[model samples]
Target: MNLNATLFAQLVVFFILAWFTMKFVWPPIMKALDERATKIAEGLAAAERGRQSLDLASKHSAETLREGKEKVAEVIAQAEKRALQIIEDAKLQAKSEADKVVAGAKAEIEQEAARVKESLRERVAELAVAGAEKILRREVDVKAHADMLAAIKQDL
Candidate 1:
């Protein structure tokens, strides 16, 4: 075979194969590659969005937890304040009750003292009349001595 003609024939066959591959096989292959690239870019974008959403959710959860802690603290403080108020009220109520008991005891004592004084006056008047009757060596007339007994009772 002639070398130049063989070289030329190989060149023509190479051009036909290149044209057939470009028209039929290469186009589908390129399309597949382009679709794959687009799918990869979309997947990366979705991953980034998921990461951002996760971060946002974490921040919101942390904020909610902080708010809950603050509310719990506030409630505890309020409960403490209420407990203190209740204790103070109890103290004041107890003191008032004690004062009322003391006042009632003092009133009862005054009433008892007044009754004893009246009984003593009657006894002293009877004793004075009896002594007079003994000194005179006779029984003193009861109705006659009524006015004198009253005067002696008043003096006592």
Candidate 2:
């Protein structure tokens, strides 16, 4: 290649323009680009932290829901147990009352039977005395009969 005047002048102009660009435009442009890069890195780190926080929160919420379900089941079981206990107690109380009533009825029946036996015995005795008097055919004195009746009653 021939070293020419035009080439030499073109090289000079090119170097001057490059020097001007590096001094004025390149510094500010590189600073802005670096700032943008830093912002992007910070935004990525923040996004990662936010995702981790969300994951942790979701796990905590799931655990809380499980615990709540367990508590509800426990409460239901306790309620069922309590209800059964109450029912059993009521049944026991009713059985006790029924037994008491039966006992009272038995006692009353025994008393009534005793009274009826006593009345039957007295009636039988009166009938026997009347039959004996009819067979004898003698008129018994009322005062003597009353005294004999009182003596027989005392002996019985």
Candidate 3:
């Protein structure tokens, strides 16, 4: 065989094979690679979105916890304030009760004093009557001052 002729035939055969492969095989391979790359990009985007969602949820939970703690503190402060008000009200009520008791006691003391004074007046009147009777009985100038003695006794 002639070397130039053989080499030229081989070159022609190589061109045909290359052209067939480029037309038929290379397109599908490139398409498959593009599809795979797109799928990989979509998966990475989904993973990023999931991570952001998780972070958002965690922040929301922390905010809710903070709000709950604030509400609890507010409730405790209100309870303390109410307790102080109750204590003050109780003190006032107790003072009023004590005043009422003192007033009642003073009234009782006054009534007792009035009763004692009335009894003393009655005793003094009885003593004075007895002394006058004794004086009149002891003075016995019989008929001479009988009329005057009678008048004095009647005045007594």
Candidate 4:
């Protein structure tokens, strides 16, 4: 084998080409890969934060719904209580009015009975006087006769 100038020049040229590729191409490639990795990591972190926020919002919405339901129930309960009270009050008033009406009716009936009794007594006395005057017909002293007739009526 012969040692040759052409082979030695070929070796030198390969070394220079390798050095140029490492300095110019490799650094930019590594920097681009690192930047891509950082961007991916930031995107994943942002997605995680968004999911946590959504979960918190859902929980808050559920709590608010429960509170609203409880408030509605409370209002309904109050309304029922008020209705019962109003009904009870109305019943009491009606009973009181009915009692007053009954008492008034009883008083009116008593008054009517007393008037009828007085009228009957007056009619009986008038009839007695007329009968005595018819039977006696001027045969007796008027004053004594009147007294006797009154006494007889009292006995009857």
Best lDDT among the predictions, by candidate number? 1
lDDT of 4 by residue, 65-138 (tens): 99999999999999999999999999999999999998999999999988887777667777877776787768
Q: What is candidate 2's local distance difference test score?
A: 0.88
Full-model lDDT for every candidate = 0.89, 0.88, 0.83, 0.88
Candidate 1 weakest lDDT stretch, 10 residues: 133-142
Pairs of residues at least 3 apart in sequence or in different chains that clash in candidate 1: none
Q: Candidate 3's error at 56, in angstroms?
A: 2.3
Candidate 3 C-alpha lDDT tens digits along 54-129: 9999999999999999999999999999999999999999999999999999999999988887676656655654
Q: Rank the models by lDDT, top first.
A: 1, 2, 4, 3
Write model 2 residue lDDT over 121-150, tens digit each, in one string: 787767766675676547775456877865
Better of 1 and 4 by TM-score: 1
Per-model TM-score versus the true fold: 0.67, 0.60, 0.51, 0.56
Model 3 global lDDT (CA atoms, 0 to 1): 0.83
Q: How close is candidate 4 to the true structure, as a TM-score?
A: 0.56
RMSD of 3: 8.1
RMSD of 4: 5.4
The prediction achieving the highest TM-score against the true structure is: 1
Quick one: ranking by TM-score, best first? 1, 2, 4, 3
Clashing pairs in 4: none
In candidate 2, which residue pairs get closer than 3 Å at backbone N, Cα or C atoms, i.e. clash? none
